[model samples]
Target: MGAQHDKMEVGDLKQEANRASPVNIIVSPDGMMYDYLNLPGRVIINEEVGASGESLSTRKPVKIEKLYEYVSALRSNSFKFLLREYEELCEISPQCPQTVGLSEINQSKNRYGNIVPFDHSRVRLKPMMGKESDYINANFIPGYKNARAYIASQAPLPMTVNDHWRMIWQQRICIIVMITGLVERGRRKCELYWPKPGFPIKYGLVEVTNIKEEVRLDYLVRILRVKIGREKSPKSRHPILIHCSAGVGRTGTYVAIDRLIQEIQAKHRNVDIFNTVYDIRKSRSMMVQTVRQYMFIYDFHLDAWQIEGDPEGFKNRKMVERQKELDSKYKELTSKDDLMVEQKATYDLYELFLMAACCCCPFLFDKN
Candidate 1:
């Protein structure tokens, strides 16, 4: 009798499963019932009803494997969408250059080492050897007919030798207005002067410590005004060249700000500054590195609220203040005279090392 009853119970369960929507049921190996429902492609599994005329006492554990499978499917769909979108974007706006980087360099081992030839076709590759003079003397290449170039000295180094690389690589621009000890050294050693002949390098050598909200704003304003003015004319000037050291992080931020300002002026729309930066980085590799720098940009846009205020009142005042305070302390630490001197000496050594290394291995200088 008990065996008959068990058979009847199993038969009823099977009937129940068959009667329910094919999409909404899963019978586990342990005979635990799971009622699966599709919630916009995401699966929600509920426990089976109990024999006691009550819901199941135990909660239905999530099927992690099934969840991952569903997520993977969604991601695949998203990637396809993005690919289609990218293709359409390329077709519609061929003028917008795709981001390129140093990783594109060949990695095959040679007798000396991995040798990478400089590719001038790359949007981001800047020749290390060629001065502005060299570019002017050379005949215009097909695509580079409207090309221009500029160079800026890197910031002062940190207290230690290891820190020097960080300072030179991470510092944004060497502004003439606020000269760092490092900039001064670069000017002396490399004969690096502002506005080198045949090039219109902006001469505003700001110290590493002085790259504050005001400094960024000032630089952005200057670049945008120049770009806007030139764009107005029929015989407009060449594309403005902006660089720092490694052509990432700070350089990316500056470029992002420039592009944002341009877009704002053109569209008359207030853009999410953080989102703009994020988008730029997504399109390029290692564009912005530090979370601190990212927060600085966010704070800068937020502080603008004191004067103009957020029209929508969406700015997070508390978070902005916290970041500003942290950045302020960083600036204070960097501005000490002894530290500044140390930083300068370190940067000088790095520049010498870089120049020497590049000479020995020409491929090291190849940015493409």
Candidate 2:
């Protein structure tokens, strides 16, 4: 009886061991460990498992590679998504004017023939007319023996009211003014400080940062605030032209922040930021490119002090830290190499990972 009992106990122990063994170490499509069998004296394997357990660790390296590939794929998918959003936005925005013509005025009977009046309230034009004798009397005709001769000499180029209007409109008045750099020409003119000669108009330079440094962020905020002063007021007519190298990621981010501020001030709910940015990109092709930029919009929304003592402060700080860590890691991985090489490798790796991820699971890359 004791021998039979011992045989039964051994069988039970074997069954327990079988239950405890890891079930093929199921790894997620993203290369993360999903579960581990709970058994006594059973060896557990993970990504940190080294080469010594190579036979038993069929999954670790494969999972790590999959993880890298998955990240790359995610980045590529994000870029593609941004491109699609930009294309859609561009379809809904205004386009720049294509042509201007002014060559037919000399031969026309009417002085202002075919010339359209400036419809904008800010501009005006006037014409003048004088007789041939008046022109001769004023000594306006050159190289003439007498008044009549002078009058006849100037007859070919008939001076009319239309001619005077065209001259005044085209030559006497300056419509467009160009200023160099961030300082506006008008602002320079109004202030006591004299601007250097030939200073060009300045456009805002868009900058990207995962960690929001107070000084830089404050400067950007101040700039936007100054530009958007007393919304729709006549004091500021200048459009704030802002661009980064490609005029997308950073540019879109600033615009998003600006829009968010406005929405919050207006006390509007249901602010669809993605749609707002999408609308902007419709007019501006290179709007938002990077996932970091997209994520920045979320950060901007959450970090904004719309309400005093918002409880999200702690959560936002944690997210910000995570973002900084991710950015640092990405920078480290892609850094220490030539820019062209890095971009190409990053892009290629991203594509491959995306392909692999999509193959593994359809919805793996669709999480917001």
Candidate 3:
């Protein structure tokens, strides 16, 4: 009875913590649930559902009403695409790059150390002193053709917290997108890297002031303005560093959404989410980690993007226009949070738990 009572008490607390705020209000699609990623709520699928594949003969844009259908097609076609992109893509080994003073496998987040960042796009932190390989296990991923991409990294351990801030300061980051907590299930996911709101915190050469902090049901978005004195400022741009427990599932998922929205703003509206994931994995070995995470990209993209075409000269202009009016969003309205997605969802009408190949293949059924 004690354990049972404890469970009930915990459930009640989650409900209270997740109670809807004005920020939680959202609209979703029919037969779909509310925004699970951005909104605070839960939906459990009682049973699995499937959809018959439709012939997709052309790359021409589909009607906005058929956005979900388009997503299904892209999903069904993902496996074959993976097979084709296998050589230059896919995870091989979990090994971190060897640096001075660190053990061959030290500071690695996982047993095999399989998901290391690529050399070409790795973020090199400014060393504290002397001679030690300033490695913190982070990757510098390039965004789509035009959008400024982010640094996807694992949660900072207690020791590496200083190096993490050093990287942020060296890079002149404008936004910090943290997807996991300091701890989860009695294990440490990330350290307390920043000061609480209304307090000034200094990490290494970087001085951080929390501009604003907004709590979301699915994640926490903090607007931060960081300054690094006596260092070269490349450009005062919005460079985001997204981190989570493992730094694959949630980190990759958020970056994918932001990049896709950038493409949408550029009028390249018909998005191939699979290709985007493939491109991201090129920089970080095991990005968009799980089958569930891949499906999440679909949910977020469908919810955020509309099929309607913007007028000529509308490149990335929607953001500037929406910022003045979108007060509920807190930060700039240029993120995935502003889009309309189903606020509640349970089981995937499409398969979710299967491996990448199986889940991405065609799901055949009566289409007539």
Clashes of each: 8, 11, 14
Q: Sorted by lDDT, highest first, which candidate order results?
A: 3, 2, 1
Candidate 2 ranges beyond 4 A from true positions? 1-234, 265-269, 305-309, 312-323, 329-368
Estimate the Cα RMSD of every predicted model relative to the unseen true structure.
22.0, 28.0, 15.2
Give the per-residue lDDT digits (tens) of candidate 2, residues 47-145.
222223322221121221122232233234222322223333334433322112122432232112221111111112232223211111000111111
The TM-score between candidate 1 and the true structure equals: 0.31
lDDT of 1 by residue, 1-368 (tens): 00001111111223222233222223333332211111123322233433334442211221222222222221232122212222222222212232221232322111112111123322222222233111110011111122222221122222112222222222221222112222432332112222222344322211122112222211211111111223221222233333333233344444444444344434443434444544443333333333323333333333322223333433444533544564454343233343333233323322322333321221111110
What is the TM-score (0 to 1) of candidate 3? 0.57
Q: Summing lDDT over every window of 10 consecutive residues in candidate 2, give the lowest-scoring window.
A: 1-10
Name the 10 consecutive residues with the lowest summed lDDT in model 1: 133-142
lDDT of 3 by residue, 1-368 (tens): 00001111111111121233211212222211121222244322122122544444222444434666655543432222112122122333233343421346443533124445566556776676556455667787778663346788877776677788788777776556666656554556678887767786777666666667664344345655566664433445545777776677667766776676565555545665656776777667567654345655665445434313333433355532432332332122112342232111111211211211221232111100
**Winning candidate number (TM-score):** 3
TM-score pick, better of 1 and 2: 1
TM-score of each prediction: 0.31, 0.30, 0.57
Quantify all predictions' global Cα lDDT against the true fold.
Answer: 0.28, 0.28, 0.48
- For model 1, the stretches where C-alpha displacement exceeds 4 angstroms are 1-235, 265-268, 282-284, 310-368
Residue 274, model 1, lDDT: 41
